[model samples]
Target: MELSEMQALARRVRSKYAAMETARYGREWTDEEIMLGFLGDVGDLAKLVQGKAGVRPRDDLDEALAHELADCLWCVFTLADSYGVDLEAAFTSTMAELDGILAAEDTTT
Candidate 1:
């Protein structure tokens, strides 16, 4: 799917979570809850990496890592949506900065 499609899907998932929260907890989650959820996903990715490094439960390392990375992206996209941020712009700018840094390092060495 395209990035726009992925963003829309993330929003739909967020709405589903909101509906569940309202039904179960009598209200939707606060922004803090969303932030914590994102952090939790990051922690999960770290654990998955550790597991692949043989520090925890062994599994299909490559597949597990891909899923963990996708989870991380979902959390990032969700958080960006919450804040009305442009993910494509952010990614583009960051990649440009990284490219410049790498080019400078190459020239220096």
Candidate 2:
């Protein structure tokens, strides 16, 4: 799906999770909780990738990896939205910074 579609889906997922948290915890989660949730998703993604890359499992891992990655992205999108950040611009800027860092290292070598 396109980035816009992904953003929309993230909002929906975040809302649903927020509702669940409120119901289970008896209050809305703090920003820290949301951040932790995002990190948790990232950890899950890492595990899925490692397994798919044969670090842990021998079974077909493609579906699990894809799902985990999508979940990770959803959490990232939610965090960005919560803070009123523009993900597209942030992604582009971060990638450019990484590229520049790599280029500078190449020149230094």
Candidate 3:
């Protein structure tokens, strides 16, 4: 699926979480709370990546790594949506800038 399609799915999942949070906590989570949750997920993702690389032992390491990566992506997409950032455009621009910098360095060397 395209990035936009994935983003739409993330929004739908966020809506589901909102309903669940409202029912459980009396209100949906704040943006800060969401970011904190994302931070936790990123930490988990890092561990899973380590496990995948055999730097740490883990059961079903490959599966765990894939899931954690997806979890991180969901957090990123949701956060971007909340902040009204065009993540795709930002990513493209950042990559282009990096490429240009690397190319210039190659010429100078």
Candidate 4:
């Protein structure tokens, strides 16, 4: 799916989770709380990456890594939408800047 589609799906899932959180914890997660949850997902992804590197053995390593990566993406999409960021545009701009820097470095070398 395209990035926009992925982002839309992520937002929908985030809304569902927010509803569940509200029912379970008296209110939905604040932005900071959501970010903290994302951080936890990142930690999980880091371990999964180790497994992928064969440093940390895991059952179903590939599947676990894919899920963790998706979880991280979901958090990023949700956070970006919540904060009014045009993530696609920002990503494009950032990549261009990095590529430009790399090209300049290559010329110097």
For candidate 4, write residues 1-109 as lDDT tens digits. Answer: 9999999999889889989998999899999998999999999999888888888888899999999998888989999999999999999999999999899889556
lDDT of each: 0.87, 0.82, 0.92, 0.92
Q: Record all residue pairs in model 2 with backbone atoms less than 3 Å apart, i.e. clashing.
A: none
- Which portions of model 1 show Cα errors greater than 4 Å? 60-64
The whole-model C-alpha lDDT of candidate 4 against the native structure comes to 0.92
Selected candidate, larger TM-score, 1 vs 4: 4
**Residue pairs in clash, model 4:** none
Q: Show where candidate 4 strays beyond 4 Å.
A: none
Worst 10 residues of 1 by lDDT: 52-61
Q: Please give the lDDT score at residue 3 for candidate 4.
A: 95
Task: State residue 13's C-alpha deviation in candidate 2, in Å.
Answer: 1.6
Estimated TM-score per prediction? 0.86, 0.78, 0.92, 0.94
Error of 3 at 82 (Å): 0.5
**Arrange candidates by TM-score, highest first: which order?**
4, 3, 1, 2
Model 3 agreement with the true structure over 1-109: per-residue lDDT tens digits: 9999999999999999999999999999999999999899989888877776778878788888788889889999999999999999999999999999999889656
lDDT string, candidate 1, 74-104, tens digits: 8788889888899999999999999998998
TM-score of 4: 0.94
How displaced is residue 76 in candidate 1, in Å? Answer: 0.7
Every candidate's CA RMSD? 1.9, 2.6, 1.5, 1.4
Candidate 2's error at 80, in angstroms? Answer: 0.7
